[model samples]
Target: QVALRCGANDFGGTLMEENISRAAGAQYGVSLSVEEIRGIIREIGRIPKERNTLYEILE
Candidate 1:
């Protein structure tokens, strides 16, 4: 959420686990659901999108 407000146009895909983050001392098993992601984006006044394998935004 902060990242979007801070000018992040793209977000990393939904992660099922946070292995690297855990190693870096971030909260363990960090994950967000699609609904949560959309809510966060909307909270920051932006729209959420899903990309296809070719990187095209899905409708």
Candidate 2:
């Protein structure tokens, strides 16, 4: 929430099995579900956007 209020806007979805952070041993687990991400963003009064591979908005 602090990050969002401070103008940070790049939020990501679930990481795939071949994700880099997982390969690099990032132990972040099960905390970033889609609903959780949307809830977090909503707490700061910002709408969450779903984007495509080319960074185009999908929803």
Candidate 3:
């Protein structure tokens, strides 16, 4: 998570439908919900911006 602390705007791959990371025993591999992501962004003192699958900002 250090990467996230270092000015990473978003947590990529959190909302993946088929999560291979979970199968590999990564507890934090679950897909993140929009609300969950928003909360995490807030906790890290940043605004949560929504984006589409193509990484386009969703207004």
Candidate 4:
């Protein structure tokens, strides 16, 4: 949230699994919906974009 407001534009991957994070006991979960992510991005006054593995926009 703060990051977006501070001019961060990248939001990383949407469908990728967080297996390494989970294995390390990060409790934020592994998956998030595109809608949910977009909502957060909008809440922070940034546009949400869906991208493919090669960083091409899908939405």
lDDT of each residue in 1-59, candidate 4, tens digit only: 88677877765533555565566698866666768878988896677776787989885
Q: Give Cα distance to truth, residue 15, candidate 2, Å.
A: 4.5
Model 4 lDDT, full chain set: 0.70
Candidate 3 accuracy as lDDT = 0.70
Winning model by TM-score: 1
lDDT of 3 at 59: 89
Best-to-worst lDDT order: 2, 1, 4, 3
Of models 1 and 3, which has the larger TM-score?
1
Q: Taking the tens digit of each residue's C-alpha lDDT, what string does model 1 give over 1-59?
A: 77677887655433334475677788765677779878888987888888776779989
Query: lDDT for every model?
Result: 0.72, 0.72, 0.70, 0.70
lDDT of 1 at 32: 72
lDDT of 2 at 39: 93
Q: On TM-score, who's better, 2 or 3? A: 2
Candidate 4 segments whose C-alpha is farther than 4 A from its true place: 6-14, 20-24, 27-31
Task: Please identify model 1 stretches exceeding 4 Å from their true place.
Answer: 13-17
User: Which lDDT tens digits does candidate 2 get at residues 1-59?
Assistant: 99789997765444344354565688754446778888999988899998876889986
